[model samples]
Target: MGATVVQLTESKKQIQHTHRTFDDQTKAFRSNPMPSISERRENLKRLKRLILTNQERLIEAIDRDFSCRSKDETLIAEVMPSIQCINYTLKHLDGWMKPSKRHVSMLFQPASNQVHYQPKGVVGIIVPWNYPLYLAVGPLVASLSAGNRSMIKMSEYTPHTSALFKEIIEGSFPGDLVSVITGEADVAADFSAQPFDHLLFTGSTSVGRLVMKAAAENLTPVTLELGGKSPAIVSPDVPMEDAAQRIAFGKAFNAGQTCVAPDYVLCPSDRVQAFVDEFRTRFSEMYPSIRDNDDYTAIINERQYARLQSYLDDARAKGAKIIEINPARENLGDGTRKIPLTLILNTTPDMKVMQDEIFGPLLPVVGYTNLDEAVHYINERPRPLALYFFGYDRGQQQYVVHQTHSGGMCINDALMHVAQDDLPFGGIGDSGMGHYHGKEGFLTFSHHRAIFTKQKFNSGQFVYPPHGTSLHKMIYKLFIR
Candidate 1:
């Protein structure tokens, strides 16, 4: 089968029509999708139940899609994040939905001002393969919580999970309320062109640009979660053993395939060897055996595996030292599909791996003069999706946090910043646009309608008759001043 999932056919036309039903009912939905804050909260409750009840199937499908994803990992990382996000919304949705109180000028003292949250109408969600279930459904929950009907375009890289999700959602939701579109490549291009009120996409930077351009045709707002080379700077103040364990755990989990995983590390030049020694010990403790091991998941497909291998070979050719972190005697054959746990040292900026986001089990260790050099080197690159620092000093942590803008950050840890539902999750500059999760997600999928109520007495009647010198003087003195 082609990378595209849906083709032009009778079946595809039916699916397309079904997915377009939300746009069809735009007028009715815009009027009453959720008239009150309580209703939006109830919708969140329903979606949370759906996720908790079906988590087993989600786990199974993810495993089938990616050779050996850990059930616990999926639940902890993806499922729990979504659940926590729902609870966060449920806890705060009412207050968010409540109109904000604005001060009225003395001239219009009788009137009131506030902003109301309105559904963005039809929402389009495009997901990627790495964590198909979570990435797909997480945005869907936000759309639904905002009281918008949705259509989801699953990643072509993860066919099995997409098919399963299609069955479940189609079986549960009315086409007009919620739908799934499983289509071939052109269909995604076509879907992107449709008139959606808003769109949210989670994928690589190149595809994110394409999705944005397509949405631009309709002036549809979009929340794009794009990727970049995220960096981790280890302050020499941190304890070696603790820092190594945390960094090792993040880089190797899911084969270092996470979007926000630290792409490389910077430490003092003299401390590089000590850091490596501690990381080596941590890897053994984390995963004693990884070959054909159910605990370690493979790259989504052979094409990606080859891409990763190409990066490794390119770095090796460029005079970078490659460190093998694999257990003794492992198979790289079809059954296991295992590549050795790999690390790189003595790397330079020109190396191919350094230039790109290494979304694989390859970690690079580079030396720097100190925190200043590390921060400067990262600043020179595209702002990252995430930044990691391993230190306990409050001033250093605050300095890095305030000085650099990332989608998010983790102090003394790696990648777990995403799990905290209270904080916003997203990127900056080339990393991508907009944010979601908790209140951010609700706000992303909503349109805050600015409303100003006027009392029986017209507040602006004095200036309305026409533009006069006296009125201009009153407006200038009362309003401008």
Candidate 2:
């Protein structure tokens, strides 16, 4: 009973701290609402320096959190992208900050109209566990670039990395400008309920709904980066080796914990076996050994491992053929949390693996007889975060692009669309809501305030209060037509 009381007290204290931090950030934003471009640039530079200086430490922390995360994967997927985003933002901040000149109708001649992008005050960022560092840094880059003070809520599943992130951010930034919140689920709920200017969440779809609900209470605008079952379609004419190799790379990277990872493959019905064989070969070549291999990344935790294992069991019981691509055939059962790249063939819509977002190293291969079948299959479900089509035919590509819906797409490739710094990344329906990568990111965090200036002459006065006046009638007759 005493311990329970102590825990309750601590929870209350953390909640209080979260509220205080948010209020502080709000106050700070009001004091210096729109920071100068130089200030924003300096903030980005400081962030880049912090990441570079502590790159090894951050990598080690994530490794500890995952038990066996690949250092190379961390560098390529997380650190590199974070730094690249900062560089991209710094290079284009000036152009994005310039007020956009807008056209005015002839009736309003002698007046100048433009759109000024103003910061949206304080922003709230909720980071998920799969790619904690990059997800946090990506949104932070956008928020800072738009000159908004932000508070980040790091996932509790990644304790080591989260704690280190909070510490490092505290050292580099003032508490009122940028703060990192770390706690349990209750704390996250409280954080979500805060009255933020804008909230950006990166996580699963189920949790995203709850976050949106909490944000709605405050009428806070949100940019949800939720994950769904992103699919990859292979054309009949495309070489099996090319399609398989690229799809295998996308699935095996970070052990398929990526939000944009290819969840399933929609292959030509006649070439299923050939594509499967090539995928197995390519995956084996990428990592010859799963157990005790530094190149192979393990699942984040035991809970996630069990979840994936259950998915395989359920799929197997539902008459799906399971293929495990373990080149060394080593025993990975000693709580290593390492799962080899597994493929599920003969999947049905009823199976859990097919119904849910397979955010692990499990890929399901679904057969399609024609292009219409493939397009219909995808359209029947909620729009995915990404869709990959493996074909070189320009007409076929155009047809697919026009007929299908996804947050993003890569023709003749997989998972590379997100690495491009110029493209806007987001989803449509169930996958997610708003874009936040390049210029879109800056705009998402800014309010496009329209401004109209007229020198000495008032054009709107002619149409003012008194109705049917000679001037008003003349203006109406001249313009309303």
Candidate 3:
């Protein structure tokens, strides 16, 4: 009982300390509201240099957290995108910072209209376990570019990566400018509850709701990047091999732990077998041997691995055909957490795999009779963060684009839209909300203030309120119409 009391007191002290840090940062921001463009650029450059100089350490740390995360995958997915976002922001900072001129009516002729983008003080970012570096740094780049300080909350699941990230941040930046907070779920709850100018969270939908609820107390604005069952549509007109390879790449990458990874594939009923065969072949060629393959990533932990296995078990028990695509068919001992790449065919709506977002390497192939059926199948579900369509025909692409509502769409490819620096990446409805990439990211972190300047002219004195005199009548006659 005495120990419990001590722990409680310490926890309360930590919370108070965190709150004090926030208050100090807020005070600092108020003192220097608008940082110069050169200062912003230098901050970005320092951030970029930090990542570039320590890329190997970051990759190894992430690998340690994930058991075995591919270094190439980290470089391609996390590091490259972060650096690209920084570069993109630096390239366009001047134009983004400039005020835009607006047209004014003749009635307000003496005044000029313009909109100036200003920082929104301190921003809070809640980073997820998967893709921790990219998710955390992406938002930081945007916040700093917009001349605002940020405090990032790293996930407890990835401790090694989170610690390293915290160290890097603390070494490079002052606590008030850009701080890193690391703790378990309780700490995350407290972090979200704190008052911030803007809070961006990237994680599962269930937790996103709780974050939103906590933020409601402070009335803080939020930008949620949640995940859903993102579907990949394989058009009958396209080659099965082409569609299968692309979908396999999307699923196989990160062991299918990505938020925007393809959750399932919609293939024609008659070509389902062909697609499966091609997918298996492509996955085999990519990895060759799962047990000994360095390219193939292992599931993060035993809990996640067991959850994925349970998903497969539930699907199989419900009469779904499970196709395990292991080219080597090597024995994975009890200690290994790597789950073989499997495809669940003949999946029904009642199956668990179909009902939930399978954040594993398990791909569920749903057969459709026609294009409309495939599109309708996707529409019936919650709008996904990403929708992949494989086809060469422009009309079908346009048709799919017009009919579907998703955060982002990629045609003839998978997971490439996220790499584009210009596109705004986000979701709608159940998947997520608001955008944070390129200009959208800048806009998200900025509060655009409209400014109107007037000359020393007596243009408005003629229409002063005098109970509708002759001048007022003349002005009304000339301008009211």
Candidate 4:
């Protein structure tokens, strides 16, 4: 999604305008022993049970906020991932918390070294509205697993879901270790300003920068999972039909509002039409009248709907073709705004769609003369949160993986990279910074301290004498070297 850009611009004032507040309760609830590893495991179990018991509430709240979030989507993207993370972390949390051993140097005989992974005190996680519960709880599943207290700040756009999450988390954990803060963007700025030991934010690149800047005041390490113009490169070798379906599936999921959603397609000049045709057919067969349908989710609000509309309007006014791929559609109003599923024959770098992250159901198909052009296009832009390559050629896939950088990548598919717990989920460069999930998340909130134990050995005592002897010079070279 683009970002609560306007909200951030007015964060200082809008925060005051909200009338909602989160400070009066901070100090009262801030006194608690930061959970130890064992305490954290037990607390995590409690949180898991709480989520399991309240799944319905989470789903219903998200559906209400989205206007129409698919139950299956909630289960797969939100509930299932969180459940999986909890399970994965629980199974390995103990091992993850153990201090690591290191070898001692012979030069300093009898000295031992160890790296202790300690939690970085309190953590701050800022969640976006698109997937409120998931964003709110997902990072906590990791931070808590790492034995750190966390404060979750949720989006104002999804007020219903944010409130429900606050209630859910409050019931499961003490407010000190796990407090949910909900208000406007100002709350986010204010919360970010707090002296958190660590901060994890999932949102737009613009806000990610501001979050990073605010956190810099405290020099708090930040994990910013932000968005950018992610490109799905269609290699020359992959089957057009298969690649199109997978890409379409990824783009269609969440109505293309996902952060890692393939923002645009980079294909060979000849195969561009074939890719678009198949994608159009696949999308229509999967969901029809999506704008008014209960299955397809509406844009979060009027402002976002207008933003997507503006992108299309700006591009079309600049002489670009816009096509609604789906045949079934209806009147859109009263929290309904349908957008073109596909835009074809548009390759200009200056077009509005080409220039921005199309978070809605907007896809721009850019034709590259060759593979180099496609790679060049991607490399020229800021490193994306995700990169999807559709190709069977191992060399080309490997080349793209090594040559260009992204938070993550999907081979022969799209948006599935984030699904893998083994792979680190995060961004590079301006897409955002830091990584999370599983070990990455644990390491993100941990301060690994290196310890060295030196023993008092009589063998080296001769080097410590005041006399300027030859042995002292030899020992100085030997020891200093």
Best by TM-score: 2
Global CA lDDT computed for model 3: 0.91
Residue-wise C-alpha lDDT for candidate 2, range 360-411, written one tens digit per residue: 9999999999999999999999999999999988888998999999999999
* Model 1, runs deviating above 4 Å: 1-15, 22-39, 333-335, 464-475, 478-480
* Regions of candidate 4 where Cα sits further than 4 Å from its true position: 1-34, 333-335, 456-468, 472-481
Clashing pairs in 1: 5-184, 6-183, 6-184, 407-426
List the pairs of residues colliding in candidate 4. Answer: none
TM-scores of all candidate predictions against the true structure: 0.93, 0.98, 0.96, 0.91
Cα lDDT tens digits, model 3, 308-399, are 98998899899999999878888875766788889999888898899988999999988999999998888988999999999888999999
What lDDT would each prediction earn against the true structure?
0.82, 0.94, 0.91, 0.80
Evaluation by lDDT, superior candidate among 1 and 4: 1
List ranges where model 2 is wrong by over 4 Å.
1-9
The Cα RMSD in angstroms, rounded to one decimal, for candidate 2 relative to the true structure is 1.3
